[model samples]
Target: MAVSGVLGVFKDLDTAIAGVDALNELGYTRADFEVLTNAPYPEGTFGEEHGMHRLGLFPLVGAACGFSVGLLITGATQMAFPLVTGGKPLFSIPPMIIIMYEGTLLAAVIFTVIGLLFESRLPRLGSNLYDPRITAGYIGLLLHAPAEKVSEAAAALRRAGAEDVILEEQPAPAAAKAPQRKGASA
Candidate 1:
């Protein structure tokens, strides 16, 4: 099914909040629309439902994997080539503690960064509901609605004092690539 998106630009935060409320009244759920702003705003600042995220698990899983890898590397190296120093026994705990600690910290930091990017929906591939005015301190409320409801959604946004509304039709499905002709240019 074809879908269309609308972006309602507002110059004031209050009007933007009203735009969100207007969309809500038009039978649009929080998931169907997103608020865009240039500055950081607390979640649910506009009374939108807080999105659930699983960022907390990333660090824990990374730490566990790092600890396991560290343990394996230390143990396997010691077991593979036995080295006697100061007549001490192999698989020494004191030295292994340092490597394991460092490994755990490194992996945890890496995973936290990964989780942050994932949670923030980075690299938005084909988002068409964006307006440059948003970067100029204007707030944008992007709404994804069925093709039939595009006008209705735009009207609702206008009622809420939207300064301008931008509409975009979702791209059609990609067509199959044309087959190369025999003896094509090298």
Candidate 2:
């Protein structure tokens, strides 16, 4: 479904919350809208009926998996290539413990960073529906409404003290190109 929308910019969280409440009172549902803020606001303040914040969870899970994998790799390597030193055990627990700890921590950090990047959809080279004012501490409430309801939605936002109501257009998808063959001359 071609999703068209309007974004209502507000000066602060309070104004944004008020605007969302007004829209809710005007028969707008939570599924039809989203709120973006520079800093996180309290849940339910902007008529956000669902507690759906899951961005942080990705890094935690990634870290756990990374730690497990790192431990397994260290243990397997130690078993496969035994190194006997002056009266030292072939598979020394103390030294191996240090290696395993470092590897596990490294993996956790790497995976967490990767997870954060993936979850945020970062490194996007294309433009997206965004307002510069949002970075200047303005809260933005974006509504995905029917084209016919655009005007009404904007009006509702204005009535609720929105500083600016702007229609956000989706950027056309870029055409896919064929991949070049490996080892081709530059």
Candidate 3:
């Protein structure tokens, strides 16, 4: 099914909030629309509740995997080679500890990068409906819905005091394109 887009611009914070409420009254949930602004707003400003993410545990998991690999490598080398030096035992504890620590740190970083990419849905940015004026002061509300509901979404935004409502008619998917610079003449 094809999903159309509606971009609503509000004159102020109050109007934007009202527009969001109107959208909700019309049966649109948090997932159906999004609020876009230049500055960060407090959580739940538009009565939207986001799901909690479990990204923090990624580092711990990564560290554990790294530690195991390090232990296997160090222990195997000591058992197989049995190199003795400076009256020290064939199996040294200090060097093995250093190697294990480094491996653990490296794994943690690798896992964190993977987790961030997965959690953020990287490389899959959707067709965003926004106006260049959004950076000037207006608040933008992007609504995504089935093709049949485009009018209803626009109406809801209007009823809530949206200053402008635009229907996006972007072309079909293509190669990734860079965002247009604000002041560059094209």
For every model shown, what is its TM-score relative to the native structure? Answer: 0.81, 0.71, 0.79
Please provide, for model 2 over 1-186, each residue's C-alpha lDDT reduced to its tens digit, 9 standing for 90 to 100: 455667788998778888888788868888778787787766667666656656666656665676677667766777888766678876666666666667667766776777778766565443244566787799878777766777788888888889888775544235313211111110
lDDT of 1: 0.79
Most lDDT-accurate candidate: 3
Cα lDDT, all candidates: 0.79, 0.69, 0.79
Which of the numbered candidates is closest to the native, going by highest TM-score? Answer: 1
Give the range where candidate 1 is weakest over 10 consecutive residues by summed lDDT. 177-186
For candidate 1, lDDT tens digit of each residue in 73-133? Answer: 8888889989986788987877788888888888998999999899866655444456677
- What candidate 3 gets wrong by more than 4 Å, as runs, is 84-94, 170-172, 179-186
Displacement of the residue 185 alpha carbon in candidate 2, Å: 50
From the highest lDDT down, the ranking of the candidates is: 3, 1, 2
Clashing pairs in 3: none
115 Cα displacement, candidate 3 (Å): 2.6
Which candidate, 1 or 2, would have the higher lDDT against the true structure?
Answer: 1
Backbone Cα, N, C clashes tallied per candidate: 0, 0, 0
lDDT of 2 at 145: 72
